[model samples]
Target chain A: MENVVELTNVTKTFKDFSIKNMDLQVKQGFVTGFIGANGAGKSTTIKMIMNLLRPDAGEVKLFGLDYKTHEKAMKERIGFVYDGNVFFDGLNLKDIKRIVAPAYKQWDDTLFYRYVEQFELPLTKAMKTFSKGMQMKASLAIALSHHAELIIMDEPTAGLDPIFRRELLDLLQELMMDGDRTIFFSTHITTDLDRIADYIAFIQSGELVFNQSIHEVAENYALVKGGLELLDRDTEKAFIHIHRAPTGFEALADNMKAVKSIFGDTVVIERASLEDIMYYMKGGVPHV
Target chain B: MKIIISNSSKEPIYEQITSQIKSAILAGELQEGTAIPSMRKLAKDLKISVITTKRAYEELEKAGFIYSIVGKGSFIAEQNLEVIKEKKLKVIEEQLGAVVTNSREIGLSLNELQQLLKIIYEGEG
Candidate 1:
């Protein structure tokens, strides 16, 4: 499959945070999730991909073409929605489409109108007047109407109700039915990725930690819960991070199968959601 | 078509999918040669990732319960009566294997283990 987004040895720096030697790939026909906490360079990396922020070094390629050389053509096929509105604030939905949608060759007015009806967004209301969910829906309508092959979103679900969040996921699922489109969904909400992310890219303190398929993530890691008494010097050393309270001890194991063979039924081996895995891995308590 | 998922369960999502589909086939809910939903369709319906659903389908195919044709879709593979019976027996064999290990650890003989198995098998009301 063709890669929709490829960043090899990409480096970026702010005064405080920087992405260092990051390598990430988003393949066609899959939703690749970019997960990290606030200020963890999720947005920064996304900006680099969008060319909003220039990388200090290395390459940023979209659809097998370098962004620097093919910015306009790449932007035409790509759709984006950020945490906040990137469109003009004073313009209404219809006005914004009149100006922005014309930038793409594949812009379909009928599709845009269809989405407006489905989203129940008023055509005349200024963009700034819409609620958070409405703003996201409007942005999505614009994005989808262009017949985009690659959809890049950063925290599009933030500040939305759970029902709306699920609805948005359903929309993304529907979009990928053709088996050709790809989505890069960057968010702090790992549970959302647990549902629809084919690949998970995790970063902490601006450094890429692990980037792998969700299948491998599920297969490789397990949440092991057991009593504190079970922890000997050898067993304690097995976890990536182990947390102990007065009552019991729980930890994240890098190899579920190995941990299962070692601990067997003595410890509770549970399926760790992306949330649990990210929490323990990025939570950063003093480790064994 | 009927699947109940518990997010809190220790079982992985793909395992839950495969086991549920397997049980349904064994119980005759999904008949032989019946067409199942495509991986992408099933993933969308279940509100899960394509990777996870694909994994489940792969597991089912591995177990000889289903088959997929490229560009077509998956269908439940027909199982002979003997094959089904053998599968049941294999399940029992595993349970008995565990029983033997536990009984041996407690120093029980074969006769005592048989008595325990018989009593437990017949004692269910």
Candidate 2:
């Protein structure tokens, strides 16, 4: 498969948190969602990929070439939308576009205005006065206006209401229709990923947990539940993480087949969601 | 053909799509050679993940229920009696397997389970 973003053994460190040797690949023609709890290295990793923060070691590549070699051209191919505005708060949509659009090689004014109309953004209002949802929409308008091959967004829908969130997800789906644009969607909202993500890469406490296709994640893991009697040490060992209650015990097993073989149909096995897997893998609740 | 997806339901979204399409084919609601929406189009309409729809289309193609032409949309495949029969049997086996599990969990014997199924089937008729 063609990869649009590749990070090989990338490492970044801060005073209190650090990303260990992390290897990531965002393939072409898909939406790859990066998710983690707050304070995880998601932002650090994204910054490294964008060259906003240089990695302490290893390389970051875009379009299969080192990001630094042809930074100007490579930057042109990527459209970015991050939390808060990347523009001056005093600038209206039109003024902001005038400043930002000149940098992209294929920026189209007609397309930009079209998105402005579609998103119902106020063309003359200062960005700072816009609602959070409108600001995000305005940012997305900018991102989608240019003919970008890859669009990277960091929590684009994090604080928006459900209506706008759905609209944003719908837009992302429409964008994928072209079949050539690759999207890097980073968010803490795992539920949003359930509907649109092709591949999901998760980070926890600066550690890479898993990066796999949605099908693999959903199919390969299962929620195993049965009477509390089944909570013997050996059975617990078979689970990725286990939760117990007085009436029953439940566990998330990474290897569904292994769990089935161990417990058989005596215990109920349920399809696990992305959120369920994430929470359980993080050693989620085990309340009794 | 109609496909209903529920976030709260236990069935995976992709499986719901495939099963619905498969049933449509078996019931002849979708005639052979009928063109179907592209995977992206279906996903957009369903407001679901593109990958989920893609997986559904892939499984349908793999099962010989649909075929795609380059650049053109996928269409329902010509029915092969043997293939359709085999596929339907597999669906039945899956349903029966679930029945077995439920019955066993409830401590119902095989004979009792069969009797209950007969009563339900006859009552429906």
Candidate of highest TM-score: 2
**Across residues A54-167, which tens digit of lDDT does each residue of candidate 2 receive?**
999888999987766789888888999988788899999999999998888899999999899999999999999999999999999999888899999988988999988988
- Candidate 2 chain A least-lDDT 10 residues: A279-288
B7-75 in candidate 2: lDDT tens per residue?
Answer: 777788888999989888888899999999988888878888778898999999998889999899899
Expressed as tens digits, the lDDT of each residue in A1-288 for candidate 1 is 488899999998778778888998898999999998888889989999999988999899999988768889999999999889988989998899999877889999999999999999999999999999999999999999989999999999999999999999999998878688999988888878878899998888788777889878878878999999889988877788898999899899878988988888999988777788778977642323
Residue-pair clashes per prediction, in order, are 0, 0
Q: Which regions of candidate 2 fall more than 4 Å away from where they truly are?
A: A283-288, B81-125
Instruction: Give me the runs in candidate 1 sitting further than 4 Å from their true place.
Output: A225-236, A244-248, A258-268, A283-288, B90-125
Inter-residue clash pairs, candidate 1: none
